[model samples]
Target: MQTHLARAAASVDTRAAIPEPFADDALVTQPQLKRLTGDVSDMTIWRWRRAGIIPEPTSIRGRNYWRAGDVRELLARLAGGAQ
Candidate 1:
């Protein structure tokens, strides 16, 4: 059987990936995260959070959301070789 990571990568369509956007401090949902991250799976995102590579979302009411600004900042840091 293919590994979980392999399966996850296979399910993604890199052709439809979008360019990263300039984000604000407004809260965004998982779908937005997937879009921003080039259509990665939810599981991948969860793993990123678990590994501390991504900021955890803030739970509000019955939903989870992340700050767009926080995501932008992290990505910038990573792009700058701060990893």
Candidate 2:
């Protein structure tokens, strides 16, 4: 019984050590976008979108979301240009 418990605990530990999969194309909401963008304000994000600096967002059920890949690509392009 002790060996069985140890094996079960080991299996649980192995599963815990595995990181969750992240989807690059997943849709992220405004709060998540703000977090990704270094905690920038909602208005700043809105302005960037309005100015055509960022990719357009998709709205579903009256909530807006942007693709994670799109945001990452935009940041990468901007960083490359800045350097």
Candidate 3:
């Protein structure tokens, strides 16, 4: 029936209008770290890590990850110190 079809279409449209779940905080990874640092090479980060320049990353499942907020804070601090 036309009414039933219209109701079905409206239901689908309503569902589509719902927003997808989005995370407020995004986790940072090594690749993101590289992008933030503007240094493409892992060796550069590795050297920074070894020299106690950058904060140590937290390891999980034998992989390392840095907090995005921490990286941002470090960048802000570095920028402030430079000026």
Candidate 4:
């Protein structure tokens, strides 16, 4: 029972980290990316990008931005198994 409860809490926490009503075509900036990804460090994002776990960001004016659609896909793939 405790294990189940812990698992449920963990799932909820992960979901809470991601903002709701994710617009498919929206371009998420660095800060928003962090929020969507459970406030992961910049290094983690770089690593994921390098590892091909995530698609490369669209650089604009020397800033990084990721498509919401891509992020949604990633979240679906990662959390699908747990849920």
Candidate 4 is scored at a TM of 0.69
Candidate 1 segments whose C-alpha is farther than 4 A from its true place: 1-24, 78-82
The C-alpha stretches of model 3 lying farther than 4 A from their native spots are: 1-26, 81-83
lDDT of 2: 0.58
How many Å off is the CA of 78 in candidate 2? 4.1
- Model 2 clash count equals 0
Deviation of model 2 at 82, angstroms: 3.9
Model 1 clash count equals: 0
Steric clash pairs (candidate 2): none
Segments in model 4 whose C-alpha atoms lie over 4 Å from true places: 1-23, 81-83
Ranking by lDDT: 4, 1, 2, 3
Clashing pairs in 1: none
TM-score of each: 0.62, 0.63, 0.57, 0.69
Better of 2 and 3 by lDDT: 2
The positional error of residue 54 in candidate 2, measured at the CA in angstroms, is 0.7
Residue pairs in candidate 4 whose N, alpha carbon or C atoms collide under 3 angstroms: none
Tell me the tens digit of each residue's lDDT in model 4 across 1-83.
Answer: 22432332344344554466867778888877665655566876787787777799999999999888887776665555421
What's the distance in Å from true for residue 3, model 2?
Answer: 60
Residue-level lDDT for 4 in candidate 1:
34
Candidate 1 residues 16-71, lDDT tens each?
33234635767878887676555667887888788777788998896778887776
lDDT of each: 0.62, 0.58, 0.53, 0.66
